[model samples]
Target: MNPPAEPPSRAALQAAASQRLHPLSWLFLLLAQLRAFALPLLVLLFGGGRREDGIADLIGLLAAGLLALTAVWRYFTYHYGFLGQALVIRSGLLQRNLRLVPFDRVQNVTVHQNLLHRLFGVASVRLESAGGLGQAEAQMDVLRLDQARALEALVRQGAQRARAAAAASGEGPEAATPAEPAPVLWLHLPMRELVRLGLISNRGMLVVAALFAALSQAGDAVMKPLGNQLYAGLKEGESWAASLHLGPLAYGLASLLLLLGLLALVRALSVALAIVQFHDFRLLAGERELSVERGLLSRVRAHLPKRRVQAYTLHESLLHRWFGRRSLSVDRAALETGNEAAALRELVPLATPEAMDGMLQRLLPEGSWPPRHWQPLHPRAWRRVAFPGLLATLAASGLLVAWKGLPGLWLLLLLPLVVLRARIWARYSAWSLEGGVISVRQGWLDRHWRFAEVRKLHALELRQSPFDRRHGMASLHLDSLGAHPMAPPLRIPYLPVAEAVRLAAALRAGMPRDAGVSRARTAA
Candidate 1:
């Protein structure tokens, strides 16, 4: 065998003096400081009836002013500074804190920008480290957007150099294959497809956003009426605006309705905004890295190494089905924290399953990709699906009949049929594991066929409750490296024991044999 070469020395970069906070941000901070100082003093003065008291007012103002000044001073002195090898942040007042994050230890880096950030030409950079607790685990806050990109480029260069140096020193054996030249792949969803995806997701995020906006407006309306009524004698009588505000219960309902309409309008606005944000969105494929840059006012940039990807997934929502569009996800095992949850590295409508497969094959190491031919669930799986639903319905019906009387009995008749249909639907949705990938087909209303790379699975579980064992069936749960605190592992019930073992073996084979890698390959 050829002798491994020594790794190269890593490079380092440094940031300039801390930039001043945005003018708006500075104003907001001042106002917040003032409020914090004044609120307590006002409360104390009113509660103690000490306004007429000697020197109290003067003392309070002095204290408040001093506190605000201190805060401003702290802000300026403890700003963020970047070094090529590590991120440096200094914070605190009396007891200061200085943190240095090495580039090699960094699991991931993300750049986030909002409308304000875009307008101000600033960005927030979040750095995730595997070693830390609670808030200390992830470092984040705003930075100048241009400066952020520069820092990221520095980090990337440093990391590459470190890897090369490690290889040169024979400290890293995997240096057989140097990082590939960054591949250039562009991805997008057409307007029609985008619309379809937006609708199908029924994700309700847009709706929820609209609802919140409407509710806030309604609350403002309600409060305005009350305020008008309370100050009526002091000023003029209530006007139309006041009557339409918070006064009576009837007015509240009207306000709610009006708010609802406003919310609907907001939802539409949000959807329109989303379309604009993601419009002409593109993900460029780099040799060893993936770069995601999207949105209008808020531009986001994420850098991911293909080698670090533990898994890949393709998902389709109802709208995705109608428009034949799919969302592609790549999971980086090293950064299996909340930061990685929202499908870290998402690509919208890259291509079809076959096309995605081709992409995966190109991106992944040879022999690690999953087989495409997945076996669907046995036809008998339908019985398992239907029987439980039926039983639950019957039990519910029996209780209703016993407690509420005859009308409940009618529910009993529909229960069995509903369950049976549900079972058939479940059965129709089939899945199989090929190579290092697991494919699942599921749906009753809007069907989806999802594919996940086996290596991405954080854990593989073979479970058989008493009932399952009796039926000679088992369940396989596959957990991905996502950041969701409550993300449930994907479960494929009604699988045979032998089949589950085979799947486990594949996952183990695909996982990298590195101590630095998480122990996700093991089967349980």
Candidate 2:
């Protein structure tokens, strides 16, 4: 029997000729182009057009043919290869383009395989660097799965070598030890946990709202019919209820029950969606990188270098508290764009508080967790928070009184609730600076804890509002690379101006020399 063949060495692979994309790349590219123009094409085909002459149909066919030809041209022109420690890519037909990306600058490598790609034994590979803003530095539409994996491995190896060389030159040979090969399993979310996560999240409501907005944008032609059908259903429901001749209390109870039933249905849909999206979710940690694998219909495999993580966030919503769960996410140096944005955010989507603490300890051994003492904000911070609520309440009450006279007086009852909320927020919100890590906590009901190593922070801002200046208090904002725009900011609000200034100086002093910390003062 013939012996099994050994895998090729790095030197051998690098010496090999430049590689082109898989033969089926054109098909995938065509499909992508069609998806991008799907809305316009649908309008051209079905909307009022030259149907008798079939001119619109002819135009669509011609457009599709042109797209197919372009895809083929792109496939034939694009070529990629390795040159020393950099990956070289050459493309473009009319105006040739060449790009060389050094492995050390690559922060994340993602491999995606939808159902179609999996069926065809192919995968889409994306390389994300720190300088691409929110876009991937390079994307390979479709490649053989084995070849893609090989390319990822090569990049990882090259990056490791670069890091080792830098460490040896800067910190001596002891700091340049090779990374461990064994991978540690960090988390494996079961179906039950996914269901819990879905229950805790408002994804279902967001999806419903998005659908409603889309329907509203479909113009009266589509929404008018839907509105009519809904109105007719409501009329039928009212008639049926009247036929029952139910008492007022009974009617109220029935309506409440119906509302609850609808909520239950929405929650069920959310559970199913979560299960489909995160089935068989697993997070693994190697010495130098973290690996995430998840999804049911469209599998995704992503790799993030450990050093690329810039900041960490812990979230605990009211629903999460009820379920005894919390979530953990990270801001990495690479900003993933498009469908890949959701790839590596949820390092721990849902877990017990104790479990999350343990995971954090294992993942970030350099930093401390659960600070022993939290530094409180200014003594009058509660008043600062409550003032806005009080003003808003007064304004709303005045408007309601103008609209409905004495009946609107009841709105003033919300004033106390607003004050209570502000008090809670002021009491819970705090900051901690310990062991080269800076942590900030905020929120009353849905709490967020954002933290980062001092060295990772790139900028700091101190701002003073007119009210803040009058009260001798200010706010501090800490900026890190690749932070999610929608996530709660890492800001410490309502701090004494002197304290804020001292804190900013201390943080800047702790930052690494090469980090180039920038400070700014702004008035708002």
Q: What would the TM-score be for candidate 1 when compared with the true structure? A: 0.69
The digit string of per-residue lDDT tens for model 1 on 1-524 reads 34754432222211332444433444345555777666577655454566555577677778777776765675565555555455566566678665666677765577776676676777666665544322333344445666677866776666676667667777765573466576576566567645554455543565676766865765654677866776985455346547556557867787799899875665565456556556656667875666666666556666666656655555655545565556666545454433223435454434555666566677655653444455666446677777777788889888998999988888778866777677767656666665556767676655544555665555566677666666666766666654333322356767666776666566667654531222222223
TM-score of each model, in listed order: 0.69, 0.90
- Quote the positional error of residue 326 for candidate 1 in Å: 1.9
Residue 283 displacement (Å), model 2 = 1.4
Residue pairs with backbone overlap in model 2: none
lDDT, candidate 2, 1-524, per-residue tens = 33534654554543442689999999999999999999998889888745698999988899999999999999998888887677877788799777777788888888899999989999999998767777777899889999989988898788778677667777323367676587788889998999998888857897889898999789988988899999999999999989999999999899899999999988988888788778899989998788988888899888877778899999999999999999988998867665455768877788899988887776664556776679999988999999988998899889999999987889999989988998889999999998778999998789999998888888887888888999999888888888988778988999999999899899989876766544546575
Cand. 2 Cα-lDDT: 0.85
Q: Please report the TM-score between candidate 2 and the true structure.
A: 0.90
